[model samples]
Target chain A: MLSQENRLSFFLSFASLLGVLLIWQFSTLPQASRSPYGIPDGNAEYQRLMGRSAVASTVRSDFPTPGAFARNAIEVLHAPFHNNGPNDRGIGWQLGASLLRVMIGYGLATLVAVPLGFVFGLQPVIQKALNPFVQILRPISPLAWMPIALYTIRDAELCAIFVIFICSLWPILLNTAFGVASIRREWLNVIRTLEVRWPQRLFFVLLPAAAPTILTGMRIGLGVAWLAIVAAEMLVGSSGIGYFVWNQWNNLSLSNVILAVLLIGLAGMALDAALAFVQRSVRYAE
Target chain B: MTLFPFSRRPYAFRAAPCDHGPALACQCGSTYPGIFTTGHENGLPTGAMSAQASVPAISRRHFLGAATGSAALAGLAGLFAPHAAMADTAPSGVVEKPDLNIGFVPISCSAPLIMATAKGFFQSEGLNVQLRKTAGWALIRDKLLDGSLDASHLLSPMPLALSLGLGGNAAQPIRVATMQNINGQAITLALKHWHKRDPRDWKGMTFAIPFQFSMHNLLLRNYLALHGLDPDKDVSLRVTAPPDMVANLKAGNIDGFLGPEPFNQRAVYEEAGFLHVLSADLWDGHPCCAFGTTASFAEKYPNTYRALQRAMIRAAYFMQEPSNRLEAAHIMAQAAYLNQPEIVIEQSLTGHYADGLGVVRDNPRRSGFSPYPYPSMAVWILSQFSRWGYLKENIPLQETAQRIFMIDEVRKQAAALALPAPEDGQNNWPVLTVMGQRFDAFHPPSYSKG
Candidate 1:
């Protein structure tokens, strides 16, 4: 959709990353200049390549060399396609489990949060009555819910979903309530004067009017749901990204752990980006 | 075809000593399957075998008639039940109650848990035993307290530590029903660190231990203090859970760690380190893991407690046999906690463990469990806890020791089969030297004396 020159600028941005990598590569070369780190200075690809090789002098005297790093990188890139490689879990499986939990929990939270938020949104007295309890629970870290969830629910998977539920419900509820309450009184008055039924008024007028704010709340809620799954998995002790990271860490496989972390970050970015795209395309009412 | 299918049968009361239940039955219905039934002669009580030896010579005709009737019934019962019947004629004071979810760390010390399940000891006593593999000793402690687990394979000092309220605010008081296993855990120090300095120069070094307040930590501190190193001020001690210690060492995040077995082997394979020290050398050989239950569990389920103890003794006897290591290793490997290659399992079983100090040359024996319950092990651990500031100044040591070690329960279980009262006795074998000093464990003392 953009001009070629503009696209070229976007592609060229990667050059900076390449440049930093090159500098890193050169600095880590087996022999560059004699720095106090004690790794031999040589141009061989198999030589000291991480620049800081002081610790490598022990067990793995020559690991993380340029060749080793390259091997590790290639191994990481192909990790998704293989079974039980150093970074064995493919992106698809990792992202699917996380996305599945977020969607189900977020959907359930929405079903409850939206209607209650609307009732409170319209009635000032009701909102005031419920505000304190919601406020008390809102700031509690989602991790705090893990023990209660595990002890209460017999199943680990369900407990994880429950944690996601606790984390995401509040934002959507508060936002939807705020969005419904803030709707211009004139819009409701117009619907009333036209003799529209209450359900019809809600369906056709108020919802569309408050859609942007509601979506904003959903966006925030979805993010929280994604965040909560990691913590939930850690507590539940089953198959999930959080457990995967923990298992790898227990095995002392730092590379796999780092790789999982990277995958989590990328998946989170993709999710946020997708939500942003949806928000933009659905922005027609405003 | 379904790999696992189900069949229904009428109510079956297990009526013989050999009836182990369907779960342990071979899928093919073959009587003795691979790694399933070892048929070790440990199920019978130790002294009962000797007492039965004194049975006067009876008439051949009378003996033949008694044996014939029982064998015919055993054959018919074997066809339907396909296992031994529960021993309904259990001696009095044998635990009257027994249904348990027994938590265990998947180590060789847990042989009793496996043997009890295999030998029909629990079933014979009307006990339903569920073995749960836990993350570490700390979780075992927590689960026992919260009733998630009825009992657990616990570190020796756990009962004492719990009673003293050493762990954070939520500490629950506990007592040891029996000493489960001993001397199985070894101290593993990283090879690189070992090469750099002797263990006596332990000052300013960081070591990994399973828990901050565990018995191993206390032992390590005392071992260091004897050599003029203050564990608190001179060394940087990091708490690494057992499962992570091997990897932590391989990755060089930690210099050395003290843990049970196989982890030491993994470190050796990685060429990342060696075990330069061991717990055996520290305290002449000390109490390690024990079976612990909440004081309430002991009170409410005294019958169950006796049954658990009886079963554990059966398991311990199986481990005492030298030939059972191969089978024990296989079982440990299958358990989710120690799921890995058979070699790691084998290495841990043989007690051919090497650590920062040197290779422990002792052949595998039942290192952890006590034949006779020892109260002194408690006093030894308590002194260390006090020394390390985990406990305040010593509070009535002997009374506390009495409360923690459930000798009466062990004695009741032991006497059922007419076995001798389990006394606090040591295998007065050879003495071990650390840093050219020989020490006798007859009276476990602080490191200065050892």
Candidate 2:
């Protein structure tokens, strides 16, 4: 289905990726030196312990080669959902845990933000009164909420969910308020002239008009929720993909960590894509 | 389920084993041994297990040979063998709670909690014990305080510090059920300072300890002070977790750290540091971690508490036999447990370790397990606490030990199980010795002249 230029671009991208892989493979070969200039630099004693030859001690270069990484990827990704007790689980299980937490927290945030936002949209005085607090809380890093959250909540799992809720809540609330407030004054006049019931006027006119903006806010919120879940899960440290990455780092297992990083990226992308589809569905033409 | 603590932070140093540009590498060619789930948990022992269950039959053969040669050993073998006395003494008709949760940091000192869970010692007394690894001693204390954990492997000094209101919780009154292990901690210095013999030469150096309320801090302070360096003024002490101790040492952020085992051994294996001195030698027979719980938990479930104490003591006894060390190491080195390299754990447990200076050192007390919570040991801890600024108020060492240690209950439980009871030091406490001077037994806790 691709055009000739599009096909050419795809081949060029594939070729560039191949080039990068080769460079990485050769530079990290067993003979590669740790020093930047491709030579081992250390005290005479260290050189003697690890011979004067430029070849690295297999233990010294913690990074596995590209072949090794691919091998690990295939082995691990092939059967991803193995549950290994509470602390150690497979990649699929961890990803599922993370996705579940993000959705629960994000869902709760939407429930509250939408209703409260409607109130603020209808009343200018209420929005003005809340603006200072909202602005201050919005810019604060979500992870900073961890210590206070843990202290007050006492449950680490709840603290993680609470943090995600706090972080995602602001965006949806602000955007929903903005969307509702900016609906054309003429639309409200039309509904009034037609004697449209309060519920009908709100649902049919206001919601349809605001759907695109609300979806945009949700898309933004989803991205932040995915990002914030990783950070929050890292601190709580019970289970989740974030804990898998942390535990691997503790073991000094870099390949497993790389696998986790890739999974987190893929998960974030998929979540954003889902929201993007919703945004597309709600788009309105002028 | 143990806590992994932090997943994404600067704690993750790009495994720059070489200048490989963060290119992911295999975690060695061997597949990581399976992490077990509940299905794997039933019937079959999965992953790295203490080959000890099979060991009892083999151990009996050796015990028979030894027993045939000696009369005293025959009696000892009968005592050492796993007994049904634990099941016989279940009090209160039924346990108020059979399913219990205990948290422990992943260290060799946590042998009691770990071995009990690993060997089905907890299951023997009808207790379904769930053991989880906590991030640190402070977190363990918090978990127990908040009732998230039923019991935890705690530092000997921690409950006392909490009871004394030194670390707050004025009348929270957590109890020490039994000691987890004894005489098993060491001071390790980064490779750069391995040659610096004198503590006097180490002024202005920063050292890491597991916690402020830990014996590592107290002992490090005592060791430095003995060499004429005021710990508070001369050298800075940072509270670092056991797992991060080696990494921080490699980064040279710490000059040295007096921390728990396997971590100290781990440093040497990684060639980041060398053993400076064993805490066992510094203060022989000091209590490290204890199987502890809130006094309220004990009051509410006496039978359950007794069952847990019996299980832990038996597990501690199992860990004491030299033959069990290798098996214990294997059990702890699993992904579901300590999740460490088995050889590193084996080295610490067996006391045959590479000291990071190319020579192998052997010392049987590198890490030891003893279940008895001696009152004198508690007194000694309180004395050290007073010596440092940790304890501000004047304390009656004897009365304090009696209150903090569950000595009367532990003695009854040990005796009922026919396990040897540590002599109660009720009337006369042991002489507080070492640190370049000896203080009489009856002196107040603030008597340390240093």
All candidates' TM-scores?
A: 0.65, 0.82
The digit string of per-residue lDDT tens for model 1 on B93-158 reads: 456456577877655566667666656767766787767655556556656776768888887788
Predicted candidate 2 versus true structure: per-residue lDDT over B1-450, tens digit per residue: 011112111211111112111221221122111111001111111111111112111111211212122223224434453234334443324777999888878788887788898888788767998787666676677678878899999988998988877865555788899888766788898887755757888899999999988888888887788678889889999998776788899888999999998788778766678777776555545678888898899889988898888788777767766678889989988876787788888877866666565545566555667676656667778887878877877767767776778555664454444443232222224454444245443554354544
Reference-based lDDT, each prediction: 0.58, 0.70
Per-candidate DockQ vs. reference: 0.10, 0.14
B157 Cα displacement, candidate 1 (Å): 2.1
Question: What's the residue-level lDDT of B94 in candidate 1?
Answer: 57
Q: Of the candidates shown, which would achieve the greatest lDDT relative to the real structure?
A: 2
Off by over 4 Å in 1: A1-112, A123-140, A144-162, A181-185, A192-204, A208-216, A236-241, A244-286, B1-100, B106-111, B114-129, B136-138, B170-173, B250-253, B353-373, B414-450
DockQ of candidate 1? 0.10
